[model samples]
Target chain A: MLKIIKPGLLTTVQDLGRTGYRHHGVVSSGAMDRNAHRIANWLVGNNESNATLEMTLMGPIIEVQEDALVAITGADLSPTIFGKPIANNRPIFLKKGSIIHFDRMKRGCRAYLAIGGGINVPKVMNSRSTDLRAKLGGYHGRSLVAEDILYIRKYSEHTKHTISHLRNQANQIDDFYQADWSVGRVSKIDNTYPIRVMKGRQFDWFTKESQASLVNKQFRITAASNRMGYRLDGNKLSQLKSQEMISEAVRFGTVQVPSDGNPIVLMADSQTTGGYPKIAEVATVDLSRLAQKKPGDMIDFTWITHKEAEQLLIKQEREMKQLLVGVQLRSYR
Target chain B: MEYKLSPMGDQSILIELGNTIDLATHDIVQHVVTCLDSMDHAWIIEYIPAFTSITVIYDPVQVLEIEANPFKSPYHIVANIIEEQIQQIAVLETKKQRTIEIPVLYGGEYGPDISIVAEHNHLTIEEVISFHTAGEYTVYMIGFAPGFPYIGGLPKRIATPRKTTPRSVTPARSVGIAGEQTGVYSIESPGGWQVIGRTPLELFQPNDPEPTLLQTGDKIKFKSVTKEVYDHLEAKLC
Candidate 1:
């Protein structure tokens, strides 16, 4: 059990998310970074899809009520345990009564925290993840706040032993630190990461200049950003047609350019259907990395054949399987 | 009907079967989905069909296992199966799925934009309500928000464009029209649709056992109700 001492800007519980509800117009409101969410659970010897805490850019300060093992993944927010620093992406064993806090992430926007047994929140529509706009799922269908007590189903004795085994081998650090056990070891692609995008259904709606500028120009993530979408500030796209489209279904990573020509990259909490002529969709594998990008982060979009994106996804998935094997081997300590 | 397939995302493939929005094509899309469900390919987790396109969600790694399953394909197999299966059902399922009549109070304080919609369509408020309620609308899709029904089958007499300036907030149950599509506002949000009426029914209740009142293929008609009846239903819904 853990009690919230200071709930930061925003924190909620999330998992792989509720699927098969798109017909109901519900977005799969889940962890923005599914890979990170799963990896945290995987580290705890739990299924990758287990529900866990989704810490936003600024994270909550939690006090451990029970002696338990925990793991932090995703954004590095300079997490501290018992006023002593802890590393993101590494499993840790905390003594009872220690307080844990995560400062605002310097480079990224969100983080994932996992307890071995997963969260005990009620699942709504086959998901426990919070959808703020819809006001459904998660703890009371809202963000976690001060004094909130989150309970996790107790781990099996074997899981307990396994947690401690890794903890015993973990080097104890004084305070804030980087992860000793880094994420699925495909190193973070550097800042100059050329994001690949596939042409959207209405890619041709824009002029040649708009299309070329989209691929060539460097766009910075705008301040007006949230779970719903990220507004990009770049060279305003010039649309050839000023026509209105019948509202149709939209999905994550969809880049919707309004009549004004500014591109708004819709994310997890985006509307189920949209009328704006979409310019492109960022590939799925890159979505996790895109979620990590903070406001003002510079990005350059590169057009890629769908085949290339699919191949990369297959490669990344294979890499993930290898990471799991590494964790299994290292679990022995 | 011509069909084309494209790899949209890593997990899904898009099947653009048709470009039309008539009754025949709508049945085609639904028919394709029902067929896909029965097939139940091990790799296909879920496939979302909307408007004229169907997105088949599959685990590429599992589906693309050439050694295990000779059919190491998602769209090709889905399309082939749909193409073959569609012929078997010579007559499309035109029978109604669900007939839901929503009780609405038109052109009153509840519907603030009724006058604007009427003016835009060059009809009286009473005529607008009569025209709107007279036609039976078919639920094309449920989207934009939970339970937001994208309904078709509106009479041409009262077809109106959306408001030039969208209001920041429109109350739930606000019935609006945007060109050919008419729908009931499921949630209170900013929108540009021209509101002609307001309904007593809660179109979307996330907590309720029946979250959305209508589904695709459902037939809907807006039945005008008096303010007194509207109050009763609203109070009862709460």
Candidate 2:
């Protein structure tokens, strides 16, 4: 069991998210940075779909109630135990009564923490992801608060083996111990790299100038952003002609321009259907990078062919599988 | 049935069945959705059916595992499968449509915005209620919020514009009208629609096997009920 000493800005349990419910207007809410979420789970010897605690800019102060193996990934929030810093993207063994806390704003906006056996939460609509709008799933369908107690699911054979291996090497250390080796950067989160996008279904509906500006102009993430969407402030993109549109299906990374002309990139918690005009859709490979961005951060978009985007995603998935194998082999050693 | 397929993203394909929202377009959308549903491919994560289009979301990784073709992108591979399946689809045999009767308590405390709707149409409160109940409505889609049915066929006489400033908290089960379309809020949410009544029946049941009470292509009818009947039904059903 783990207890929340201080529930930072926002923290919620998430997995890969729910499917087969969007037909009923359900939103697929999950971790913003899925690559990091999967890495955290792999490091702890848990299934990729296991629920992990997703902490926002500010991370929670947690107290371990039992000995457990865990991993922290994604945006480095400067996690520490006993005033000593801990490494990211590697397996960590924590002793009972150990208090873990994150102190400063570091590389990314969100961090994922995965335990050996994963967080135990009743799945709603086939997912443990917190959907703040619908108020379902996750821990009571809400963010963690101070004094919240989280239980761990039963550990698998792999997890048990990994824990024992780490314990054998922790004789000289106290409170916590992390692996010497760590997974290298999965994807670039730095804003210097432009996020790739594909033309939307209604790309031709916008004026040529507006279409060019979409890729050429740099947009600043506004303060109004949330799990639902990132409202961008930049050149107002206007359509060639206004058309009456009925609500249609939308998904994460869909860049929709409303009547106000500001493009809002729909996130994991966005509604299933929207009536706005879609100008572009961010490439799936770069969604993790976009998820790591904070408000007021400047970002530029670049055009990519649909085929290229698919190839990029396929390549990333292969790399993730290789990483999983590498972690498993290291656990045996 | 002619359709155009486009990419919503790398993972989703948007198949536009028609250009307008009408019975013909709705039929094509339903036919395509039924075809996709029956296939049930492992790569297909889920499909969301809207007014005139259906967005089919698929897993690229899963597609690669099943298909050995390395040159073809996952989108193309899945799109090809969909194109092949949909082309062989025969003209849809009309299935029995399910019509759900929603009991509503219109006006007074239950509906604060009924007056706005009545004044906009220059009709009396009673006239608004009669006209609303007289028209037969069809569920075009279930969207915006969970189990929130987008019912069409509203009487033109009672159609009104949405509220200038939306209600921060539109009570659950509130039947609202925005433009020519009308719907019930399955959950408490911020909305811009003009609410005219409240229903006692719960549309969204998260614990149920079939969580949403309404489905796309279902028909809907509103029947006026007294406060006592509403109370009795609310107590018995809820």
lDDT of 2 by residue, B195-222 (tens): 8999999999887899999999998889
lDDT by residue for model 1 (A10-34), tens:
8998988777788788878888887
List of clashing residue pairs for candidate 2: none
DockQ for model 2 equals 0.86
Docking class of 1: medium
Model 2 misses residue A55 by how many Å?
0.5
Candidate 2's error at B213, in angstroms? 0.9
Report the lDDT of model 1 for residue A313.
80
Residue pairs in clash, model 1: A84-A175, A85-A175, A85-A176
| lDDT at residue B135 of model 2 (Cα atoms) | 86
lDDT of 1 at B236: 94
Model 1 lDDT at residue B215: 82
Q: After superposition, how far is residue A62 of candidate 2 from its true place, in Å?
A: 0.6
